[model samples]
Target: MRASLLLLAAVVTLWGAHWPIMKVGLAHVGPLWFNALRFLTGGLSLFLVVALLGRLRVPPRRDWPLLLSVGLGQMMLFGVLVMYALRHVPAGRSAVLAYTTTLWVTPLSVLILGETVSRRKVVGTVLGLAGIAVLFNPLTLDWSDRAVVVGNLILLVAALVWALCILHIRAYRGLSSTLELAPWQMLLAAVPVTGAALWIEGPHPGDGTLTFFLVAAYAGPLATGFCFWAVNQLTARLPAATFSNAMLAVPMSGILFSAAALGDLPSGPVLLGMAIILAGMATVVAAERR
Candidate 1:
């Protein structure tokens, strides 16, 4: 339990940091190209790691459904949609909106997974969502702006797509361990993303600066590859709703990371929102312990 908790913390931290790092990467590349490169780099890095560990093998046939589900649904579609949205939305706001996955996951878990969520978990989810509302503060947005409205809507769709993938991950009854299959899943995602980049954005070469490569290294290997693997590991260990709710911390940490990296400092409302999110996460953890 302690180990799982620790791993969850690490995953949240990496994913939180990824938002700002991703924004930096976008400066050097088009959204689609950047998305493609991120998956390609992540897939190759994980493949290398699996090979070095002598654990590399073709995924079993039974695992293909799950591979396709997560690769296409979670990694590819989610990444593409969010990247496009980020063109118009701020990273911190995008992080908060994208994690609306908690809202979709909670009810879906009960409906599809047939899991009984405890009262505490329900309360925790509500608290976490309330915190998200605080952070988002719809009044601040220029709703009249078409690009921003569309971008925000796309983010919600991305969240729903991610929620569906989470349910599928919970339902998977496959042979290969998640780590062994991760590289292949990422490979599957990379193909379509790269194709889309070519079709939509043309064959334009992106920035080749040393800084771009540095950012790509972090975004691909550590954030996308390792973080996705860690998340799947935790998903298998915890209830879907519990795990999803706990992820509310991602945006809180993203806000802080953005402040440090992008100079988008958190205001009083942001701090309050972070506190509420922490409380909500703590509530979920307490429920899980019981």
Candidate 2:
């Protein structure tokens, strides 16, 4: 159990950094291509690892639908849309908004999975959102323009899709192991991401430099491939609250990634907002623990 928790914790940190890492890659590659390469390469890498481990088990025919659904919902829906949102907003703020999925996941579990929501979860949700709102306020959102409002709204939808995916994963019964499920889902999601990249970015994504290739490699093999493996295994063992709370690391991870790679430091509102968000997530997590 401790090992499982650590695996998920590692995933939380790696995935948290993903937003900033992908943002860096997007400087050269189209958002579509960036997602496409990450998943395609990531999925391939997972397949290779599972094959080497001899732990790969194909999902049963009955489970294929569920896995595919999860693939689209979690990977394609969350990945593609978040990329779109990132193009319009700052990566740090985008990281905060994307996690609204945690809030959405709480209600979803109740409605879809028939899970009971404790008062703690409810309060945690509110506090988390409050912190998110504080972070968003610095943007001084202008709804009059289509881009700003539309951008924020798009990110909200991305969060919803991801939240729904989390619920669906819990409901789906066919998964045999995280290793098998992680790769297959990536392969499934790769379909849409590649299709979108082709449609928007055209056949050629331009010749990437060494830096571009390096970032893409990290995103694919390390971040997407290994991270998914870790998440599947850990989430399978833990409660959603435990898994989601681990994600409190994401905002901090993104901030650090930005500071290190982008040569940027977080502003006062961002740091303040991140602190509040962590506190709120802690409240919810503590509530769940008790």
Best by TM-score: 1
Model 2, CA-based lDDT: 0.75
Per-residue accuracy of model 2 over 1-290 as CA lDDT, tens digit each? 66775775677678777777778777878888888898999999888888899988777887776687668887778788888888877777788777777777666677777777677767666666677777778457776778767778888898887776666677667736667778888999898778878987899763669878888888898888898667656555666765565565676677777777777687787778777777777876687668
**lDDT value, residue 148 of candidate 2:** 65
The TM-score that candidate 2 achieves is: 0.90
Off by over 4 Å in 1: none
| Structural similarity to truth (TM-score) of each candidate | 0.97, 0.90
Root-mean-square deviation (CA) per prediction = 1.2, 2.2
- Which residues of candidate 2, in runs, are more than 4 Å off? none
Per-residue lDDT over 1-290 for candidate 1, one digit per residue giving the tens place of the 0 to 100 score: 98998998899899999999888888888888887887888899999999999999998889999999989998999999998999899999999999999989989899988999889988888889889999999989999999999999999999999999899989888999889989998999999888888998889737889878888788788888998888888888899878988888898889889999999999888888888888888889899889
